[model samples]
Target: MSIEYGEAQLLPGEKIAITTDTATEPFWKKAKERKLTACRCASCGHFRMPPTPYCPECQSREMSWPDLPGTATVFSFAICTRSPYSGEPLIYVPVVVDLDGAPGARLVSNLIGIKAEDVEIGMKVTVDWNPIQDDWLLPIFRPV
Candidate 1:
């Protein structure tokens, strides 16, 4: 079965590569296991999204991948009505979620399981994994 994002259907063979980097490999690896992981700096103890080899805050070269609760609040969002790829009118809510317990970390993901018009700032949400491929997983969000 293919993954469905509202009116858009993502087939098996249509899956794209999530990432190909040594530094960010752990993030994708944990996602495949249905777990959310973020890099926490060993120096200043700050969480960094789009995981990097060095900490942006403290410039620390040491980092660790910590398991996240996957619970968040919608800091901001936008309802996209036009498909950038196909140019067909579609509906999708893209949200920036402020990770719970991770003060400085925010993840950009899509909101599902609800209508676009229903999404609002500060709405509680939880992560939902879409297993598009055997090794790749997409982290979507749904209202909690």
Candidate 2:
């Protein structure tokens, strides 16, 4: 993938730092096992699909991993064709998906298995998981 920036860039498969959150650690651990886990606020009874320690709605610390709807809609997207570094263009579409059963909750991921030009802002999409390493399984998205 190419970055729109003209200066130096980072490439895929290159080492990078991923900030982890205590609330989301369980989600990641479950992702390592190829399961999509989300968080739900026990107090408010609202689900946070991406997982978080405190509920953004009520600021309650009573959170737990609950089964997600495993469905989403594309709230926004961008057609990306430039890689961070110079090489064969790895075209990808970046999108923010609003999770079902959790209004206003969204997560960002690459839109794969479809042409970038065909992406739309309000398109229907779904979650996808790909294991890149022994311990890292990334969550991606695709058209439904």
Candidate 3:
């Protein structure tokens, strides 16, 4: 259960682990379906990233999964010129994106479809899916 991405091996079954908790299962399930979902507090109407069992704002145990447009802005980024694992020359930029729908939510992902030097903070981006398997997809962002 391993797939090759460039020179790296991606083992979804081995590398990806989902918790059996009720609060977090939906997020991973929707991601596998190529949809972006965020957890919202039912009591205080607050949204949270890295979904948790209880809401931080109101301490509510009720949560709901809502679909997101997957649009985001580059909050910060770093360009990796060398791979730490393989010691190969790499030109990828990993960005921290501020999601549009969730005000305080930020997602860490790789920026693609453009050169690393061209990336800038506040750049508009949209989500794209890279299929790792029939039931697994990785979320990537590209310049819009």
Write down the lDDT of every candidate, Cα atoms only: 0.78, 0.68, 0.75
Choose 1 or 3, whichever is better by lDDT.
Answer: 1
Q: List the residue pairs that clash in candidate 1.
A: none
Please count the clashing residue pairs in each candidate, in the order shown. Answer: 0, 6, 0
Query: Clashing residue pairs, candidate 3?
Result: none
What tens-digit string does per-residue lDDT give for candidate 1 at 5-62? 3532222323444645878888888888888878889889999887788898899988
Ranking by lDDT: 1, 3, 2
Query: Cα lDDT for residue 47, model 2?
Result: 76
> How close to the true structure is residue 94 of candidate 2, measured as C-alpha lDDT?
69
lDDT by residue (44-141, candidate 2, tens digit) is 87777567667888999997766566778888887656764565565766678887766656887777766666677888887777555444767777
In candidate 2, list every pair of residues with a backbone clash.
1-83, 2-82, 2-83, 3-82, 3-83, 3-84
Rate residue 98 of model 2 by lDDT.
Answer: 84
Worst 10 residues of 3 by lDDT: 3-12
TM-score of 1: 0.84
Tell me model 1's lDDT, rounded to 2 decimals. Answer: 0.78
